[model samples]
Target chain A: MKRSNRLVVLTDFFLENPRKHIQLPYFVTICETTKSSISEDLDIINEVFQNQGMGYLQRSTGAGGGVKYIPAFSRENSMQFIEELRKKLEDPARILPGGYLYMSDLLGDPRTVREIGRVFASAFSKVKIDVIVTVATKGIPLAYAVASFLNVPVVIARRDPKVTEGSSVSINYVSGSSRKIQTMVLPKRSLEEGANVCIIDDFMKAGGTITGMINLLAEFDARVQAIGVLAEADDEEEERVINNYTSLVKITNVDIRHNKIEIQSGNYVENHTDS
Target chain B: MKRSNRLVVLTDFFLENPRKHIQLPYFVTICETTKSSISEDLDIINEVFQNQGMGYLQRSTGAGGGVKYIPAFSRENSMQFIEELRKKLEDPARILPGGYLYMSDLLGDPRTVREIGRVFASAFSKVKIDVIVTVATKGIPLAYAVASFLNVPVVIARRDPKVTEGSSVSINYVSGSSRKIQTMVLPKRSLEEGANVCIIDDFMKAGGTITGMINLLAEFDARVQAIGVLAEADDEEEERVINNYTSLVKITNVDIRHNKIEIQSGNYVENHTDS
Candidate 1:
């Protein structure tokens, strides 16, 4: 293959498998190329990934180690990817009765998940994220993937504490659906005081849990470096309780009768750029 | 290095970092040996993996392909790994006054988590597991890693319907705490009707949720081939609720007053086994 195409392939591999730790023997075997040849290819790809300021390819020495793509892409890429995703998400087929949208396929899609992880990773590229926090259930995967990329641990706040967790700090927040007091908890030492934390959730509705998480972070004197959600329901009448956060895509409107959903995004796109 | 030691080191490499697809360059880099030497090592290792009825390693042709380990270990191995895990859970120091075992460190331990995944992967090796189902949120990572090994997909069953998950199929059941109604959901079509599914969770309490899942699986006519939990609390009462199941560890008892927890595992030290 031509050198340019090879570089494209290499970069594409990194982009497709975001937050994945991979090694070189697999690469050489797959590529069926000499080590010198593969090394040359990686050298060029690494320079491009670094020069572009999007992400860099990192090589780990010794056994059980290989090349890992350290994604440094910015929020702009997030917006770009989401904009494209929004179009698909807006398809009438995705719209269901009761104003709900179908997103299981997207959530399960590895490629899409990778794209989502990269977006969050890019947004927090410069911030020293001590931990990624998310309320139980949906947000765990997103939190886990992004934390893995950032090489930080993930702390899951449970809707109901387990005896196994023992002596957890609890918070009561209203569920997005019932507006009833739902309790959540985290281990006492899960997050250090003054720790720089990033809060993420699969979806944002009224942002109530996000607020609770922020409060929890504050209780520990932890700073909220950034907040991100995979999708934000964009109904204005829902009544917002908090502000200043980044969402990969914003739902501008949803028409259950017509099976249509509209979305654009915030300036987090234009304001955020990767080289 | 001695041949036996070399095998151990190489096996560790394969276990530590697994991939669906790989390349030769990655292996050469990992082993830090000549291409031929590494190839020979892989030949032996591949045979070892295959002979043990574990996953097979397939080498792909072309410039970007390499060897891929198709996970095919048995559910029997999962039973064994979890048995050892139960030993850790039984440590009295892990108990709380409230009769709960402390598993935060076990949950946080990556090495343990990886091993859990490999053993879990052994189960359902034959089934085409399209989606791994688990009630959130601790089950999230176990589901993710197991899915990665199986090279399939995973879906988290939320305690309740979220704004993002459209039109969820909700099932009400008792949670671990035995408190109020705990609702979980599997989005419609997330698991195709009649699809063979494998369920995994971090812990089993009353087994209410597991039974609820079995009920939900009935709704879709999906088959639940096996159920695996990281730990099975061994209280005589709880033990009655669990049968025909496998666990990493069995928590015999928790003496919260003495901060003593007793554990026994059936995983690592199985009788009459040779690699």
Candidate 2:
């Protein structure tokens, strides 16, 4: 193939497999090009990826060391996406009967979901995420989005058990906001033992649902390496059920009858951004 | 940006917005390039995409005509994915109590889901799909995957009513296999009225669930442009509740006691491949 053809193929591959390391020889074999030529092509690709702020390439000289594509967003860029999302989330029309915020519209949008996925992926870029864990049914899409960008699988815990999944492990936990006990179950084969898991959800009220996922991960001996949510409702106690978690939007207030809602950027803006 | 940079940017944009038409001048402004230069670049990109079978570019000359990226998989490639997936799915270990296939693992897999999404997108490339719809829990990921490729939002139907979503429209449909009436609900604001919707699901037993979705779309004055499923349970009648649809795999047999299962590629193989 010609150099342009190789560049196009390589670009497609790298973008699809973000955060994956592609060995040098593998590229030479696939592109039917010499090692030196492949190396030169990568340099050009890397420059474009970096200049575009899409991702970055890491190089190391040693065994088990090759080109790794790390998708990233500058702190400024990350904040921009979160702020724009926060603005949309603060609309009073999204207020539900309870303290909940209706986020189905936002969650259902592919463009919005893709941006959120990229933002979360950038935030958790440093962590090792083998699989993404979420609870059914609303969190499934958000978790899937994050997992896709991270190039990992998603394991969803269901509140209602179905016989179609064979045997399962169940766990009961307290709801963060409702203060009600809820049962969530995961299929036996849903996750691998000792896997590094990342928990993602569409909304967090009391932090209880995410905590349930954390406890559920323990059944498989998997570790919760990171926790992220699209929105998190604030409480008077000022401490969530699960600590060390990041949320993109912080819901400060929701007045149902008055049709009022208030929101601000979450910890992600302060933590994930450069300036 | 230079021509090389323009090429890279254009490739990424087209890949992300599959099935969406982009006018020539839009690229001219975005890439800071002449119309002739942008057209030349698209030709090169089109060649690589066609050769790799990832997608193809369509060109029209008259007014209201523009370039469109159609994601597709050649018949040989579509069969390869389905056959390989069928082999794994046919394992007795994946058998559930009532002849159901345990597909959560496959559904959660990003790579596998991407291929399934590509096949479905390719199959429905010519249709007018304004939105993708699916019933919640298991089908959310599959729906999200397809929506991403099609560059459309996903509207998921809920089995249980949640107060957070405000007003909703509910529908009752008998499941094709269970022969039991089940209720599925969608928020009123989930979809635009009269939109062209493509319904997708994880698995279809009696074709009842998809039928429910098609009925539900009627409440929104929406048109069912297409229907797709990851797997279809073969029935004795050789016809499902919904006559118009596509499935990636056909489950021929499942015997739990004997630990035997059988599968084959679905109708998509004959319909989607570019022979």
Candidate 3:
């Protein structure tokens, strides 16, 4: 195949199997090119990826070392998307009967969900997350999006008991906002023992659901490596149940009567230690 | 820039915006390529896409008739993956209480979900689906996956009523397997009037949920263009509520007492009218 054709083929392959290491020899065989030529093609791929902020390739040297394509949106790209999302969230028409904001439109948008996934994946890029965990219903799509980027499996916590899941571990916790006792369940085989799990959700108010998830993770011997939310509802008086979490947007204030909403950049917008 | 490098950028962009038409001038500004050269690059993309069964370019002639990339996986590829999935479904361990299958793990896996999306996208590629719709919870990820490939937004019908979604139209539907009444709601503004929609779900028994969706869609003046399910249960006595649907796998038999599950390729496995 010509170089142009080979480039397209290679890029497609890498994209299909993101975060997987492809050895140099494997590439030479598939592209029908020498090691030197394959390496040059990779250089162009890496350069274009970096220049366009599409993603990056992690390179290793010597024996057994190979490159892996890690899908990531650049800081600028993430910020730009988040800002637009923030503006969308600020609309008065989004305010509900209470302080809640109607974000179903944003959640349903493929571009918004994918970009949100990219932002979270970029934020947690340095972390080792074996699985992405979230509750059923609203958070499932968001979890899947992030899992696709991180190249990991997602384990969802279910609110309703499912006979298909077989025996499951169920727990009851107080809803921080409503103070109602709610139950969440997970199948025994859904998650691996000692896996590093990332907890994600669509919205966080008083952080009760994630708190329940943290407690639930204890049963699997899994540790919470990271926590990310699309939006966090800020409550000045009541303290959040957990910390060390990142949110894309923070709802600073919401007035139902006046149909007013206050929004700002989230903690995830700040630079964090890279591994 | 070289033609080889430009292919990388252009292909990446097209993939990101799948099924969306891009005018020729848009490529000229983005890739900094002359009109003639851009046309040549598209020809290469179209050839590779067709030859490899990757996808096809829908071309329009002259002004306002730029080509659009419609993502698809060849029939062979789709069959290979679906057969594997059928085998996975046949595992005795997947047999749950009351003949339910343990498939949360499969739903969570990114590669599995993406391939499932590809199969559905290929099956429904001919249809004009303005939006993808599904009930909340298990179906959200699958819906999002199909929507991603179709390059359309997903509109989830919430099982739980939330105050956030302003005014909503709610409908009660019977669960196919359980025969229990369930309520689902969708925001009034979420979908456009008279839009064409694709209904998707993870599993179906008598197809009550999607049938309810089909009914609810009428309230919004929308129409169900297509229906796809990952798996459908074969009940000997009962007839399915909805017809003319595609399924990747069929659960032919599920005996909880004997811990046996028989799986077969679904209606979608056959070659249909390829528009």
The fraction of correct interface contacts reproduced by each prediction comes to 0.33, 0.72, 0.82
Q: Model 3: clashing residue pairs?
A: none
For each candidate, the DockQ is 0.19, 0.71, 0.79
lDDT, candidate 2, A1-34, per-residue tens: 6787788888888878877787889998989999
TM-scores, each model vs. reference: 0.72, 0.94, 0.96
Residue range A38-58, candidate 3, lDDT tens digits: 888889888888888878888
lDDT: worst 10-residue window of model 3 chain B: B266-275
Candidate 3 regions with alpha-carbon error over 4 angstroms: A273-275, B256-258, B271-275
Which tens-of-lDDT digit does each residue in B1-275 have in candidate 2? 67767777788788778778989999999888898998898899999988887878888888977799888776667778888998999888887877778888888887788788887877887789999999988877888878887889899899888888878999999877767889999999788899999999988876778888888889999999999988887778536667788888888888878899988777777666573
Identify the leading candidate in terms of lDDT: 3
**Per-residue accuracy of model 1 over A1-275 as CA lDDT, tens digit each:** 33433343355456545456887777676566666676777776666555445577778778887787777764456656878887888887777656777777777654466567667877787777877888877677777667655766778888777665667788788766457887878887577878888898877878888888887777788899888888887545578776878777777788877667787675457546662
Off by over 4 Å in 1: A1-54, A57-69, A73-84, A172-183, A238-241, A265-268, B1-56, B59-93, B108-115, B161-185, B238-242, B267-275
Ranking by lDDT: 3, 2, 1
Residue runs of model 2 more than 4 Å from their true location after superposition: A63-65, A237-239, A256-258, A273-275, B60-66, B236-239, B273-275
lDDT of 1 by residue, B37-96 (tens): 666666776765665456666777777967766665544565556656766666666656
Q: What are the RMSD figures for all models against the true structure?
A: 8.7, 2.3, 1.8
